[model samples]
Target: MTAPLLGHMMDVPLLVSSLIAHAARHHGNTEIVSRRIEGDLHRYTYRDCETRAKQLAQALIALGVEPGERVGTLAWNGYRHMEAYFGVTGFGAVCHTINPRLFPEQIAWIVNHADDRYVLFDLTFAPLVDALAPQCPNVRGWIALCDESCLPAMKTPVLAYETLLAAQDGDYAWPLLDERSASNLCYTSGTTGNPKGALYTHRSSVLHAYAASLPDSIGLSARDAILPVVPMFHVNAWGIPHAAPLNGTKLVLPGKDLDGKSLYELMESEGVTCSAGVPTVWLGLLTYMRDAGVKFSTLQRTVIGGSACPPAMLRTYEDTYGVQVIHAWGMTEMSPLGTLAKLNWEQSQRPPDARRALLEKQGRVIFGVDMKIVGDDGRELPWDGVAFGDLHVRGPWVIDRYFRQAGGTPLIDGWFPTGDVATIDADGFLHITDRSKDVIKSGGEWISSIELENIAVSHPAIAEAACIACAHPRWTERPLIVAVKKPGAEVTREALLAYFDGKVVKWWQPDDVVFVDELPHTATGKLQKLKLRDQFRDHVLPTAAAASEQCPMEPLDANIDAHAGGGAHPVKSAATPD
Candidate 1:
């Protein structure tokens, strides 16, 4: 065997600290704006942020935080939280971002699982922290992400963030560490059982940022002011924190105010040109804008992910508001950026309908990621855009294993099997059909719950919709639409079912429409289908008798309570679309 030739390039490690240092040196004057928890906008520069981050590292070191120790945070997206992103990771400790929206017990379980040495929180989460203090025995202490005067009352003694930083001089230099060292720890939104952690290394994080900032991905640049409506705790805000600094782009962190009016005000006031978040947040913003009769001034584009974006929502943003909607798809395991739906020149020049159809897909993979669809027999499927199968992906940024090796190896033959069932066109565009667990199998045919839900919400009268599997005597399980009506809108179940006649195949139409006051959602803004399935497991359809002539079933089950000719509670007037 011949020995490999060595390159003459320098071998500098790619640490998180280097990103902040580079930003401070080159883009020192760029602004990092944040709507703080104190109901006021806070502004700073990259240079200031870098200095405080260094001071924070010094403070953590003074508190005996050792290398590779886990540091937890339960706060909104703001300046202090941003500092912790670089400080803890830069100083060789792991930054574990805890989602505050999770149940207190779940949060405690996650904190204990990570064995967090210190938990920092905003004043808004003071009560939550107090509630979780006794449960999380592994947490050493709690630090409030506020000044001394603004500290909130809590059962346990809390350290003041500003006070801790004030004691340390901002002269500490960032330490160089191995690029493969773990830098960030983010847990999946444990919908099934206990949450599993995805530990990210400095190398993976840096590579993900570079790929995500490319022209075909998030497309970040210095001229754009990017607001990550996606929370910092969610896959590191889909890696925007690192990408923004790397690209010298102005960063705007929306604190806790994710409402439409607040987001509009922030974007207009900050001159934000690009933003990113889940479909639910954008739906709220679009609804608010339509009602207020306003338009966007500086916002040009947005990246919607975390769920399957509805076609109508994408149309509204582009046709009505002039904002380009870039549909994205990924999971917590893939550094959450597998594919972005950016059109090539050839696809972009197609007719409006054709272009929109292509945009509706999840788009193509970026450079580093490789994806393919496989069948149940473990054979790879053809990329014919029609034959859908289990989607599998593997890349540099993808996780080799979970934090604690939870379910043994999560990869099959070197590829991580994403829980999604999808199709890949010849051009490499990935179109997600449904989640493996959420896809409905009726009479041996696969029906996409996501497609059904999208069609249900496309109706003007429907606000939010969820399609879940209901037990059927004839077909093992059938699709049932559980929807919430828009405020002041009147639509009957018959009319709503009729609206889907031409949109989808006749057999794919839901067996029944059940109006609910609201639908449940997971902490990360995903539809909680598991809960819905449990709630209506035995719901009987009106066509049960006709579908199965031999067996006759009652129209309503014992658990079902009638409300305005539909199952479950009566529809509430004020319910809004997700």
Candidate 2:
């Protein structure tokens, strides 16, 4: 006979509406603050937010919005945008957050691709909507996210957001939805070609929120005032909108002004205890604080993601400000949160430098996510941390397929290739070496451009740096360091090269350094390496001239600087080809 099975639990589906309802019922008095684009502060409670969200939902349904249809939002992080997120998803429709920073063509393409029936935008994007409306034919209506008095005089007819909500009675109940139904849509930043959409289901979003709010993740609680410096259009502000409400944390939304002074002021005024954003955002805040001779009083911790957090920035935040910096990693495909660098008990007891080294890596995976690295031969690599391979992930919240399967199945044997080259240590810390496309292969040996750039940026004179593979006849490809110097700081190539003398393997050093006024970045503030590569595609290296000018040097061993406490040794310069 078969073994007896345990009794099944409750049959209720995991819906997004339940999160708001719980917050309203239990944490109704908690504050949701916003620095509005209209140059004023807006404050409300969970009760008020839920009431307005319900009214907006009623308005949407009354305007002929059908279940499963897409509703687009082109606005900043504010109470109104939060209401739209719950209103659309709670009503069983998809909330599509469109990045306003994207080019007009790309924005139009995304709107048309999603077949967005209605687009609600902020007053700041009035001209953008007016210009793109002719291109997005499928977008049936435009609604400005403002009151009737504040609505802009647009070329096309547009409705006022507050007026629409005021017309609804808000007595409607949320429909019982299939947990697997699509609730949110976000597109990846199209670095290669056209962008691709990642449709998140209600179940996946809810689970992501739960996992993100755990102690090891964002660690949201009633007492913590959370500020999301990241925009709502990007990966649902890295899932903060949902996670904050689910955990009943005070929400402080920095609307459109993300400058250093603006963010610092918001943090102080709101008594922000924890925050989340990219490194560039924090860089500005740090610079502003340093210039103004200020410090964080209530802010205790920050979660930095979007790109690798520079070691210098991490040290500055911890050593100078007494604030803990949590390094996070994720992408649009993984619901934008895969790992957070939180130390365990044993790791927390380690020496300061050792713990700081661990903090440099991306943290361990949360409970709902699974991670592994595979070699070129399709074999799973060990967690020894020395062998790097293509990173792959699978989880309940991870995407099994993209919206409309734009490029067909993105999974490889049930696991999604994260397109990152990484290594995981015995303690489960993930160290990202580089992107598969960004890794430099020289003389059949792999070199990490990210490592070289990180070390370069640590120099006091350097403001920012990016390393790319330039053409080299002998090694096939050699690293070229492109940098932007700090204001009024004069530094030379030889001095910068000396900074990396003992830090990395001799051959892994950059072949040459070039200073530019600025480096290009993506709309999301990531280095645009592709554009850099294309710009320098046909350029020749300076190795030939250096070889003719310098004396021949001894060849260094393959395992240069391999042992601990090994002294720095001179190796053949880049001029001497392998």
Candidate 3:
């Protein structure tokens, strides 16, 4: 190792394999703990996991799993999944993660599209595989990600994951391979529509994980106990599992059950210091803790993403829960993590609420992430907060393009043009106004659905709101506001409309309001406005936009005529359930 080229860039092989080798070589006793058979806990150290992974790799090769063949895993985040993360990919096969939450058709399509030749699934998802196995041609066999006793009683051919590991030589050596070889494939969250697979090379996944581990990003260390609440199938649980082991962090997995009671118990038992998940997960945990009289004396911070965080939601965790919630922003195209909201030390002294307010905005871009905002005309916009524009990002770990999307263009001039419309202030905070598709266009002016949703969540009675653009036939498109009232709470459209007063421009208000049981979410937990639009496309208020145009528009209500601003309110009409 002649003067190991310090500061010089090393590719994915050096980043991934070398780190595991070092861990097995040095910090081998660090534990990788997980909840296995529902209530039962399973644990393994880095030394055990690495050696098992080596054995698994040899087993895969012996089973005729060709290099570059897509190896699918339908397991929860745990020691076994972590081992497969290395075994399949480290041995030169592509790892394809199939989300269990997806509709059966979508799941089948993803697995088929990726040409998965082998599937390693937890016994929990055994029924799903049994039902779909007949349809999946490329999947030659199934490997149960559990011990022999936990194997499902199914007629389909199944191999016990642990049993197979038992038969392998623990000392099998890793074969030398090119750093640029394909390593993993993850599809976009099919929220808006169909999914597309993003091919990750060994070089790309390793690089992205490193950037995520940096201080300005996740800053994971061996001293921290990291729990990933996000499912392993979701962009490799935002790549935390891989990054954590590389940086020697103590890893904890909340397998199978992700509810608050289970997670809280594990966090306390494991002394988990850090966790990452979506807003919904925290919502349940906070609710459970408040009701169950539980406390996390050691839990310090949480990273929340998948959807925007309401300022109020941020306040609860930071003020009431004693846990810091750092809002992050990203897409599947960016290897998932592009921005994190870990504020600087100076701002750390701010009051809890003030700090929570800062957490609402997507914080500064992380290392290896470059962002820009451009208007509809493709010209770059100033960073001034008022000029909200489409966000574009280009980074080393971000997707250059999708896999096998024959002629599709996912990247523009080397930049992965993020469809989010956000504004970056001089201080580097990102205030995302809306998604390009969700922004309602009233007479060519944009109305942000995200703003309405954020504001709606602030109302005492509102649980959630989704503002969808409805065809007006005159104004092109107007907002259709839908709210799901909190349990046993009476919140009419009139009440929600009143709550929005003075907070946003009058013209930004939805022309029609609807109360619904729930707002649909995509597979990744994002609001599905496209589905909302399709659901309500035909049903529109005939007189809503017309009234706005007929009256004299007010200053605060840009599109409203003076008389229009004071015209018959949309709430007076019946809330459209359709």
Best by TM-score: 1
Write down the RMSD of all candidates, one decimal each: 12.4, 12.6, 12.8
Residue 306, candidate 1: Cα error in Å is 1.1
Better of 2 and 3 by TM-score: 2
Query: Could you tell me how far off, in angstroms, the CA of residue 224 lies in candidate 3 after the best superposition?
Result: 0.6
Error of 2 at 523 (Å): 35
- Stretches of candidate 3 off by over 4 Å are 1-15, 345-356, 438-578
TM-score of each: 0.79, 0.78, 0.75
Q: Write the per-residue lDDT of candidate 3 for residues 89-158, one digit (tens) a residue.
A: 8778988887776556667888888999889998888988987788887788899988888787996889
* Predicted structure 2: clash tally: 0
Clashes by residue pair, model 3: 551-561, 552-561, 552-562, 552-563, 553-560, 553-561, 553-562
Superposition-based RMSD of candidate 1 using all C-alpha atoms, in angstroms: 12.4
Q: Which lDDT tens digits does candidate 2 get at residues 1-578?
A: 99999788878999999889889989999999998878899999988998999999999888899999999999999999999989999989999998776567778999998999999998899999998999998787998999988987889789889999999988878889999999999887553356678899999999999988999998889889999877788788888899988989999999999888999999998899999876557767877898889999999999877655556667778888999999888877888788889999999999988898889888799999999999999899999989988999999978888898546888999999977778899999998765654655443234557778889999999999988876442343568899999999989998998888867667777888889999999999999887787677555568723422221111212111111101100000000000
Question: In order, how many clashes per candidate?
Answer: 0, 0, 7
Model 2 stretches astray by more than 4 angstroms: 1-8, 438-578
Supply the TM-score for candidate 3. 0.75
